[model samples]
Target chain A: MQRTPFYQKHLDAGAKMVDFAGWEMPIHYGSQLQEHKQVRSDAGMFDVSHMVVLDLQGAEAKPYLLKLLANNVDKLKESGKALYSCMLNEQGGVIDDLIVYYLSDTAYRIVVNAGTREKDLAWMRQQLQGFDATLTERSDLAMLAVQGPNARAKVFSLMPADEIAIAELLKPFYGAQIGSWFIARTGYTGEDGFEMMFPAEQAEKVWDALVGAGIPPIGLGARDTLRLEAGMNLYGTDMDETTSALTSGLGWTIAWEPANRDFIGRQALEAEKAVGVQQKFVGLVLEGKGVLRSHMKVTCEAGEGEITSGTFSPSLGLAIALARVPVACGEQCSIEIRGKLYPAKVVKPVFVRQGQSVLS
Target chain B: MSNVPANLKYADSHEWILDQGDGTVTIGITDHAQALLGDLVFVELPEVGAQLTAGDECGVVESVKAASDIYAPVSGEVIEINHALEDSPELVNSDPYAAGWIFKLKLDSTAELTGLLTANAYSELVAAEA
Candidate 1:
């Protein structure tokens, strides 16, 4: 199994290791619940080096990304701005969901899921046949995500004097290059923090510094619960190559304003839009005993749906799930768990945002 | 190192039984089992007065990672359940021996206790798995 630069650090911290997409990564240090609560209340760090980072350069980078992604790159007006978008196939099925950072007019940085790295790279290369864009995967870098209510303060307190000012000025969804590090004020845990990418060799030092500054190391176990509670869509679980963004709670990520611009899946998406989506993505909260899990059949007035991602929400003290139900389904539904049906309430897909409950 | 209480008898599947000196016994998952399952987020306990057979799945322990079945170590009718687990499932992780006991069962047959492993044997089983 492939190991990240911080694999030894994880072992030193008494982490339970698990294989995640070929990477031997930490599942948790001890109690995943405590680590989750720590991130929500104080500060926690995650070793996210397994995620792939690619640099797209050259004059055609702008045009290349516009046609390559379902979301228009033109929306990124300023440097250091980041946009979340889905790369689609001809059938409008999602290839991958990614974050693209507009570093400059000619250079852009994109981060894709680790599990889909090979396929995503191959797809991006195929799309670059005519464009002058050059995609370079950065293998010499390690990434860390420090997240929570006090995450920024904890991280900033450890930053060098010269880098502190620029780091403080970074707004959400924005990033900046400081010395050899690239720091972004964005996260997946619905909290304020920085996702920093630095030299792979310096990872241990930086991780030690962060831990010394009172940031606890979190494992992938809590990461899943945190993102699910935040109502974020996990790429493979929530949507995959067989799913479309419109039916996966990601309709807002698609940009279709420029009528003349023909993206890869424009025709297919337009056709689907014309016919109206058959299924709708919704969040569920179990009202009865039992935890809701993925693949559990959800029965509603309209028809049967299935949970794509479900988990017990530590913050809400209840089980929550994201499911794709019939578009006409109402607020109440029943989930079949272990041959028994349990009642659940339908609500907005986001359960929490900015560490606050979004559900009423 | 996993904690295997010397006073308890264990099933190969990791459930532990405590003989109460009456025709009754208390049951819960072993500490090793709880540690393997990670943090408990939700738990579904068998209802009081529910009949269960040996090796039958009677309850569920769910963590952020996954859900595991809590099997009945011996056959009997459940006389009582730890209702506190309904609201605070973490007890399974915090104190898997005393406060996390799933239920008390009126032992259908005392002979069934002979099939359980001793603390030393359970420790060996956990070591072999590791």
Candidate 2:
């Protein structure tokens, strides 16, 4: 199995290693629950080097991305600005959801999910036949995500004086190049932090620096719960090649304006929208006992649905899930677990933000 | 290595049983099983006086990560259950061998206990699995 640069560090910290997407990644240092609570209350860093980083460079980069992404890259007028988009197939099926950072007209950086790296690269390369755009996979880079309420301050403590100044000026969803590092104020855990990327060889030093600053290392187990509590979707569990962005709680990522953007999935998405989207992606909070889990059957007054991702929410102290239900589903629904149905409440997909519950 | 108490009989599925020498015995998941399941958030136990067959699923232990079925180590009637777990299931993770005991069972026959693995044998089983 492939191991990241911090694999040894993880072992030293008493991490429980598991096979994840062909990589030997840490599932948790010791206790997943306590690590999750630590991130929610303080700061924690994640070794996210397994994610693929691809740099797009060429004169046609702008035009290429406009046709490539469901979300328009034209909105990213400023350098270092990042836009989240779903790369879709001709049938509106989600190929992958990614964050693309616009550095210049001829240069942009795209980060894709680790599990879909090969497929995404192949698809993107196939689509670049006519365009001048060149895609370069930065396998030489290692990435770390420092997240939580105090994550920024903790990370900034470890930065150089000049880099700290540049990092401090970054706004949400923005990135900046400081020395050899690309630091972005973007995260998956619905917390304030920086996702920093540097040379793979420098990973141990960077990790040690963060540790010296009192940022505990977190594993993927807590990462899943943190993202789930924040109501974010997991790629494989929540949506995949068979599901469309319209039905994956990602409609906002699609830019329907410009009237004629002609993106890869435009025609299919427009057709589906014209017919009135059949399913709605929503959040569910169990009203009573039992933990809701993926693939569980769900029923409401409108129709039946299935949970894509579900877990016991560490923040909310209850079971929460993301599900795709019939568009006409109401506020209340029931989830079937182990042959028994349990009641749940339908709420906005966002359960928490900035370390606090936003559910009402 | 996980804690495998020297006096208890173990099931391959990771349940542990402490024979009280009377007809009644106390049972719970092994420490290795609890570690594999992570933090327990909820637990479902068999009703008191419910009959169980060896190897049949009698309850469930739900953790934050996933749910695991609790199999009956030996056939018996559940005489009592640890009700404290209903509100705080984490007792399973914190004290799986003691206070986290899921239920007490009255054995149908003493012959069944001999079929279980001894502590030394169960340790080898855990090591092999690991």
Candidate 3:
């Protein structure tokens, strides 16, 4: 299994290591519950070095991205602006969901999932036939996400004086270069924080500084629960290459306006939209005993569906899930667990945001 | 180091059986088992008066990581179950030996006791696995 630059730090901190997408990653420092609560309550840091970062440079970079991603890249007018989009196949199926940063007129940075790196790269390369953009995967950089309510404050405390001003001025979904690092005011946990990418060799030094600043080191186990609570869709579990963004609660990422923008998968999405989407992604809260689990059956008056991702929310102290159900499904359904059906309340996919419950 | 009380009898599957000395015994998962499973989010216990045999899957413990079956160490009928686990499964992580006990089984025969390992033997087993 591959190990990140901070592997030794994780080992020294007594992390429970597990194999995640071929990487020997920390599942938890000790107690996953404690780590999750720490992120929700105060501040926590995650070593996300396994995620691949690719830099696209050339005069045609903007046009290349426009044809490649489902979301319109033209919306990124300001430098350092980030756009969350899905690279789709001709069938409108999501190849991968990613965040692209508009660094400059001819350069952009894209962060893709670790597991889908090779496939995503191959797809991007295949689509680069007519485009003049060059894609370079930056394996030399390590990524860290500092999250939760006090995450920014704790990170600022450790930043150099000159970088602090730039970091403080960064708006949501925007990034800026600070010193030798690129810090983005974006996160997966629906919390206020920055995802910083820097030279891999400096990972330990930065990690130690964050730890000294009282930012607890969290692992992938809590990271999953935190993102789930925030209603963020995991790449594989929530949606994969066979799933479309329309049915995966990501329709908002699709740009349908300016009808003349002939992006890949536009025809299929338009066709699907015309035919009407049959399945809708919805959030579920278990009203009865039992924890919701992925692949579990969900039944309602309209039809049956399956849970895409499920977990016990640490903040809500209840089992919650994201399920793809028939569009006619009502606000109440039942989830099958261990051969028994338990009632569940259907709600919007987002359960929490900004460290507070958004569910009614 | 995982805690293994010297007085309790252990099963190879990591369940602990405490003989109450009244033909009834309390059963629960070991600290090692709970630790491996991470935080327990839910637990399903067998109903009272349910007949169970040795090695039979009598209950389930679901943690955030995965779900595992809790087997009956020795065959008997369940006399009582820890209903409190329905709302607070973390008790298994907090106190696996005492308050987290899953059920009280009325043993069919005391002769089954000899099949279980002593605390020292169980400690060796856990150490070997680690």
> Would you list the rank order by DockQ, best first?
2, 3, 1
Tens-place lDDT per residue, model 3, A1-360, is 899999999999999999988999999998998998899989999999999999999999989998999999999889899999999999999899999999887999999999998899999999998888899999999999999999999998987788899999999999998777999999999899999999999999999999999998999999999999999999999898788889999999999877888889999989998999999999999987678889999999999999999988888888999999999999999999889889999999989888799988
Note the Cα lDDT for every prediction shown.
Answer: 0.93, 0.93, 0.94
Over A175-292, each residue of candidate 1 has an lDDT whose tens digit, in order, gives 9999889999998999999999999999999989999999989999899999999889999899998988889998998888889878888889899999999999999999976678
List runs of model 2 lying over 4 Å from the truth. none
Please state the error at residue B91 of candidate 1 in Å: 1.4
* Runs of candidate 1 exceeding 4 Å displacement: none
Cα lDDT tens digits, model 2, A1-360, are: 999999999999999999999999999988888989989999999999999999999999999999999999999988899999999999999999999999999999999999998899999999999999899999999999999989999987877798888899999999998877899999999888999999999999988999999899999989998998887878999999899899999999999989888999999999999999999999999999789889999999999999999998888888899999999999999999888888999988878888899987
Backbone atom clashes (below 3 Å) for every candidate: 0, 0, 0
The most accurate candidate by lDDT is 3
Better of 2 and 3 by TM-score: 2
* Candidates 1 and 3, the one with greater DockQ: 3
Candidate closer to the true structure by TM-score (higher is better), 1 or 2: 2
TM-score of chain B of each: 0.98, 0.98, 0.99
- Best candidate, DockQ: 2
> What digit string (tens of lDDT, one per residue) describes model 2 on residues B73-98?
99999999999999989999999999
